[model samples]
Target chain A: MTETHWAYAERMDAAGLRDLMLAYGQDVWNLAFILTRSRDLADDVSQDVFLKAYRTIGTFRGGSSIRTWLLAIARNTSLNAKRTAFMRRTILMGRVADSRSSPSAEQEALARRVSDEIWMQVLAIPYKLRETLILQAKYEMSIREIAELLGISEGTVKSRLARARRRMMDAREEVEQDA
Target chain B: MPDREPEWYRRLRGNPLQEPGFTEEQMDRIERLAGERSGASRRRTESRNVRRSSGMEREGGERSEMGRSRNETNGPAANETESATGDRVGESHGYGESRRGKWSGGMEPVAGSGDKVRTGAGDGRTGRRPRRIRLRAAAAIALASVLLALGVWRFGSGGADPAAPGPSATQTVPGGGTATTPVQTPTPQSRLGEPIAVLQLKGMLAEQLPFSAEDVTGFEIYAARSTQALTVPKERTYVLLQNLYNLDLKAAGMTGVGPDHYLGSSESATLRIQTKTKSYTLDYDLATNTYGAFGGTVFRFYADDQVWLLMQGLLNAGSIWAEYDRLSEQSRIEAETRSNADEPVSKAYSPERLQVAGSDYNGWEKQFLPLSSGIRINDSYMGTSSLIQQLGNDEPEVLRVGNAIVFATDANKTSDGVGVGLTRDEVIRKLGEPNVKTNTRWDYRIGDYLKFHLLFEDDKVRFMTLTMPF
Candidate 1:
């Protein structure tokens, strides 16, 4: 979308905002879930992303598509939530296991779908690679867009995507061999 | 040639991954939260406005108070009151706007009484006013004497009185007297040209020094993994010092006088701030959000958020200039390599060329020929029409944007067995709710990548585009 199109977010009224939430809510929630790997955290982060957007919409400046902008906010909010003392403690206590063993209903459904095992593997990879892979493969973000959103160099994004795919492929091979 | 992603990756675009169900209830909650935030923001703005208007009233009162004191005291007391008012006004201007507002708010009642006293003095009846004025003058003199004594006591004790009126204190004079007791503003000690340890460490950090290249003899960085420190160039040292100088460091406390004072086993990095006479080492522990300085004694200090990040970035990089140069070079090479490759389409819709070993699609390609060739919902009208035309179909209504190709009437059924003329319930039984839905239109994912848009009329599928994957 053109930069001018994003200005709609700045002037968006309640109805416009509702339409926005309807259109991109899933994308925002999905990105948040991928980054945090916790449904509860994703819900909180998604709410926070919209709240922040509402408060700072005047500063949007039409720099990116509203979806990309919301996703970027979701990414930052998720990372920040993960960095909190509470989340860190949870992570340290090993309560936040891989997606297959995660207790969330969505995760359970994910684990049951043999075709969806690729997602479980995506989640198993390191955070940086997993995030880069999801943004590229799932969200269809360009390398340049991912780099800007993550505040990293394009070279780093490319390298992480490559590494993430290789790791997923290896994990798939292992699963097949076991079967 | 660049590496191709495996075919199984296409599952990501398929609706295999289930997002948590977002309901109207959740949207209502979001709206409610936003409303509460808006209300709070409005209240804050109104509070500021009220404070501002009250501040203006106080300023008017202060002026009247000054005039009354000048008329009533007409002596050293008057001069002292004028000086005190002047100092308060100076403080209001010197400090920030919020503090200025605070000063005005605090002085309002005192200034209001002064206005009343001035009005009393302005009365035409001069007989009783003389005695009242004399009584007020005597009280002002007595109050001034007490203040002078207190100042002397404080000075002799070599410490500030804990109960002394500070900048934020609201002082009220007894009776109707507008004269203010003299207040002695404390002078902060200078730490110029002193040894880092001997000087007031906290004050020195807070002070802005007139730094020159000659002041810093050496600047060294000790990386977390490195045992020895690397001496930074003078130019870079200046930049680093500038950042350090700008830091607002709050004195946390004095560390214990042993190796145990060091909080962590490893530091993020250490900086040696070298001057001509002495070298002060600052050890930063990012994990603990604390830094220790060793300048004859260990002192812990905390930097504000921005300064802390600045310090972390500089130390983490070990060499900021080198890191920047390396990243720039790497970016340039990556940009060149990317330019050589074909522009990547959305990976969701892009045809997968590389198959993963031992993975099989059971005649998936034959079942969905048009979709396999990338024709899907939301594809450009021109592109979809051209593709359909190329397939040798001369359906006249195909060029119309909203015209639906009825699968029940047409030659093809989707791999998922979904066809046009299917009831809304039947379609839902097959595909579930659309990812995006409106009253008239519903969009469902064909796989992970392609979408199947169904146009509805009278609660039934009138037109549908794209075939779902098996």
Candidate 2:
């Protein structure tokens, strides 16, 4: 939300940059984490996004909020990272690797009981729908804001939101039927 | 009782799913990378300034013979900066610390090669210049590839494949330009009747000018829609034409009747080439050639490269054209990445949007449709005023009523849901309260680049307009 910080970021010192990292680092990380659904992927992406933002600070024209611009950059970077070897390997071998990575009884118990099935279903949704839902339902972004951030028309944003809501409702219906 | 919120939606808004914060070690590495990038950006800026100053000093020399300036050819400043920055960065990033390090070993040679260029260019010998140029070109290509790769990944496309004219015999303008005119030797096209034609021509010229503007010596394109001017050096102009057709003016069916006049023809159109000639009378004698005063021939081509010989001349147009080219590419990539779902964000105004009758904002946006027909924007650099002029069908003077943009063009398109002449209270009654409101103004978002701003006078709608896309 501190959108004006980038106005002077071009000449900002290490201290200023550190302050910025502290201020907005969590939000950026969370955005990346939501998109990737992996903390480690979020970590790499958040760093890359900040480095890119620091480098391209001069290109920010002050026409939009700095947060919007940074989020846009994060979206691009995260998508690009998706094509890299690490991400591909992670996604392809993830279920097995995730089980292998945490074989303890406590981890299994936590996954079964603590984790919310609906939230997991939300993450399980396709990226485009999931992102649209997250931005609107979580961040409370307006239709216009989502369209602007995603670089799509407002009509498209509305359609995507409708589709995402329908999918969530269907998932809920299946869960209730099973119950 | 109030309806319970969706469990998933509430959880998304709550703090239960907070991801872990970055560790100290990750922050340190991130800081170091940011520092290196920032330092590189600073060095690039400094190098550009050095090149500009050095190039400007050697104004009368034939530096462009190499198709580049002396500073670019020498390239000491950039090389020096790169090497110095690389050393600092290498030390900070712990490059070469481990064989299987995250930092690539290829960075070392790139930095070392910078030093090589600085030393080689300082020697100033012709023999090794060829090899040096080749090496520099290779390095430049490598750097360009890296940047291009970044662009492709960022935008998920090959990136804006700008349809630039090949660097060949013909000298097509960089930005788009006029169509090859109809075959009439001296009959100029009627300007007033061909407003749309002229507008389209201007759009093309703006697009093509980016590529060929380097040929122009003077540029003044934004004065009036009817008149524009361009100039190029006499010798360069001749080279451009001669090389384009690969023929001499005399051999190409042209007769030089006067010192500055040549008449030529093709199968269809007659080409009249005229130049502004000047002579200096000698006051004193030189060793064996001339007198006290010396004159260099500067060619001035007037309007009418086509049939009637009308239209403004282009000045040192290449520079401006190049800027537009760069900015356009940036916009294209940004838009592509933003709208990556196969369907490009439609710039077209939907007819359905206009059908909303009884809305207060109706006529304002419908005003843009008729204006949008013939008014094509080649570059985003143009302002709202340029588009408004074409839509209103009024002269610039008549349209210059107030600071506010006039959205009252005569079109049958239905209103955008809101109309003019509504009071602040009435507008609120119809459209609900604006997202953002001030004492005298109200703002509402129609889309990303589209917004409505209303300025009120005495609680009445004094002016209202939609924001234009860049």
Candidate 3:
């Protein structure tokens, strides 16, 4: 009998891998964007992570959900992308802000609000704390699930979230004072 | 810090940082890339197999060297590592439990002992047996290949042409192209359309008129079911009968060869009918004046009196038609009763007038009230839209605003049902002039909050909205 993808990992054809990748495309793409703080880099990281997962799917065990496993891969891929000088230079020049011209006036306004200096402060926060907050606020991932995905302890996830929230609150206060 | 999140955080919770999803184009590109990758991987596996086979041949000369190599390659440590890797891979894909039974034990020694290898060196004994076994396997595979070719040659290719079209996918749409989809097979529920009623019923007679010819020269009188004869203009009768026959052809799921020629089949028999080109079958009832297929035995208009003898072999006694006629009459009676009981309430006749319209919407029945009379109950949005049932067929139903009554009147009704498509001027003329007229809306006030609003777009009544307190 022909072996299924489940029974034979290294023997899995590209179609099987592609079907698996399609399910988590959105989650991985959004996670990459939140981490990289750049849509262009997020696109690059998402493609790279899927290709990499296709190569290393055999190494994956059932210790975590496929989504969690893919997210773990996405986290590492985003971190590696962020460290590149090209991405660093883009961030330094404040060119990472989304500027895609939206046709709808309401959507454009909302995008502008999301890209405001307040969100920039959140981005300025350390990577670990920033990802923790984004996962909580944006994805609504629980502390335990975030810990399992990030390969960190639950206590570490909770502390990171608290620190991220404090920094964002303090940054908002400072902006108000300046205004 | 407050326990609650900030407004920014709250907004972020509800709406994630929106990212553009993978487009269809990207998905297609990904699939193409995957196919290429898999093809490359298969090529690599094929090359590996070739290399391994060649290596085995070269090592066949030295027995001891081959044994040592095999031990190194297929050792217990290597087997354990493979097992762990397989387990991990299987676990990821949800097949871990089934595979746990597999590879649970340690690998067997490739050569039982060094003593066995020494014994093999004395003679070329172990080598000759493997070569003979491989030869037998090769012969079996070759024989199977020959048999397969013979089978295909005799049965597969000769029996049927792979490319020959067996059946037409659909009917030929007259004068050229084939139909993209098949014609709908007739059913009892299918609306009676020209020629064939789909079902044999007396009610079908009411739909059309038929005529008879006095000169039965070419037409032989089959078992004549109807004795009374009616005359119609020969030219008109010919065209009408021809069209009715075409309808019958379609209803029978057959294509007509020519006028009065049809080829169709029932479960038990195939029917080929050729009646006189000018003549057609008429129903027994003269009032309905309908044309139908004539059959003293089968469902066809027979041109000869042989049908009388065939009628004796008939299995059924027209009970199906009788049951249908009885049900049709029963439904007609029920519809008449409903029409009388649920007659549209006149505005002058309504005892319940709006008291304080909006404010007095207490103790309102959440059921269908007599006020919603004349308005067709739109069951699609039943109790979904704010617990108030929406009325009308396709367009939104118009009821008197702040009151339950529907204004289904000549003044209110327009070409697009009640209160729709009427001009502001036309509506005013019909409803005896509006009590209030805004720039965009004309309101006919019945009470404090109850009113009929004629919403206008470009001075034409676009639609109407009733303001009921509910």
Candidate that scores best on lDDT:
1
Candidate 3 clashes between residue pairs 3 or more apart in a chain or in different chains: B195-B244, B196-B248, B209-B289, B210-B289, B401-B466, B401-B467, B402-B467, B402-B468
DockQ of each: 0.06, 0.07, 0.04
Provide i-RMS per model in Å. Answer: 25.7, 19.2, 31.4
Error of 1 at B417 (Å): 72
Under the 3 Å rule for N, CA and C atoms, how many clashes does model 1 have?
3
Docking class of 1: incorrect
What's model 2's interface RMSD, roughly to a tenth of an angstrom? 19.2
What does candidate 3's lDDT look like per residue over A1-179, in tens digits? 12234434654466665666667777787777667665555555565556556656675555556667777667755654443322112111112222122113323443564534456666545566778887777767778888766544687678778877886787788779998
Question: lDDT tens string, model 2, B1-470?
Answer: 01645666676764314334455665665666555552445654454344344332111111111111112223322212121111111111110111011111011111122322211111221212211101001100011112233223322334542121122121333233322222211121111011111112111122211112122222111111112212222212322222211111111211222122111111121121221111101111101101111121221111111101111112222322222222222222232122112221223233334233322233444444344222111101101011212233332211111112333322321254354456777776666565444455454544332244455556765445443221
B168-227 per-residue lDDT for model 3 (tens digits): 233332112222221222111001111222344221221222321111112111212221
TM-score of chain B of 1: 0.22
What TM-score would you give candidate 3 relative to the actual structure? 0.29
lDDT of each: 0.41, 0.35, 0.35
Runs off by more than 4 Å, candidate 1: A1-5, A85-115, B1-3, B15-21, B42-470
- Candidate 2: residue B292 Cα off by (Å): 91
Please list all clashing residue pairs in model 1, or write none if there are none. B13-B448, B14-B447, B14-B448
Candidate 2 achieves a global lDDT of 0.35
Residue B150 miss distance in model 1 (angstroms):
72
